[model samples]
Target: MRRLTIWSIPIDREICAGDNLGDLLGATGELADGDVVCVSQKAVSKAEGRVIQSDPEHLDEAFEAALAAETRRVLRVRGTTRIVETHHGFVCANAGIDRSNAPAHALVLLPEDPDRSARRIRDRLRFAWNLHVGVIVTDTFGRAWREGVTDVAIGVAGVRAILDLRGTADWTGATLRVTEVCIADEIAAAANLVATKAAGTPFSVVRGIDPAWLAESSARAIVRDSARDLFR
Candidate 1:
């Protein structure tokens, strides 16, 4: 009896540095209660002026500096591929410095503070429409030993990123020992299906979720601590 709807809302303008993304989003269709907005990480980064130019023929000094600046620690390196831990505790390739869809010889870094960005967007939407909703900033990431990539929530605001069903009875009357669902991440993945890179879409709205799960929380709550991390 549960239902949800995901739709991609395209912004046709070329986003630039110092652009007011809050205003840009507000200009879109009016938001409603329980609507969760998923934004592309590249869009946020572009607006934040987090782009750098690489050399034309070879990797330049800027590339190395960027890699070092964004990476907190190197986890693994095979040939030219590197898996690093970002300062935000995200484990990804090259600290999530993306070059796709950017201008020639340029790369886009992750938002400076994704959680803060989400909060700012959430607050702006509330102020504009007096609507209580959630915002999630998403990025594509490959799974360990898995082919292809899936979108995940790197930032969240005004919503609980996880649903802790531990100790809750299941359909068979069995208690769930450890069944925490990353709600925001699931929403991001669904939205990403519509906000495809080749489709020229970078944002989506997800509807029909439990608003009770909408709270003032950041995606940091979903991050696994280093102490509990089994993979390097």
Candidate 2:
């Protein structure tokens, strides 16, 4: 049986530049095989010094033009509120420039290489604690049809991102269709149950997953290229 658990951790200060992820996690406890550690992207970005100070409310004519050109269409602009789907295929408010949870006059940008960051964290945890565990960097994302937002995997390591059951037979001997489970995304969502925004829990440990699904691989495997994205 597959089960999930989320643990609330105490992260007192904002994760800033030059923070060691391994040390932070070790201070809490030791990890074990098949364990999944979910980390919020906000902390990862902060540790990487990706914060920027900018007034998203005021965009010059040139900035507006650039945004329009990059998106290939006019994005939603209501007064100062702007939501755009960039050419890189990310749909976010203010082009992913986040102002929440940041110090005054600063906005946090997504990490440049989230997958690499996940790998780094995983490796460090393994080296420091001698544990085999998976790491997932999560971010809150709005779905296409959903009204509210949910946490999704921005980075993952040491776990199978997708559980492919294409040729697997069902109970009635019928082949499964569209049964590629997004295991990483599921873990991220489960972690959010404990790592809530109001609770200030930026980290959570997910336990009780099938051991066979654990593997050392890049999160890039989960990203669907435009040419292969059937929905797009």
Instruction: Extract clashing residue pairs from model 2.
Output: none
List lDDT for all candidates, in order.
Answer: 0.85, 0.75
lDDT of 1 by residue, 1-232 (tens): 8688889888876678887666677777656778898988988888888988767765456677898999989999988668999999999888898876887899899998999888888888788757677999999987798999899999999888998899999999999998999988898899988875775576788888886888888889877888899996
lDDT of 1 at 10: 83
lDDT of 2: 0.75
Instruction: Give all TM-scores, in the order shown.
Output: 0.94, 0.84
Candidate 2 lDDT by residue in tens digits, 67-126: 455463344667875766554455555555566677665766677777888888888888
Which 10-residue window in model 2 sums to the lowest lDDT? 58-67
The collision pairs in model 1 are: none
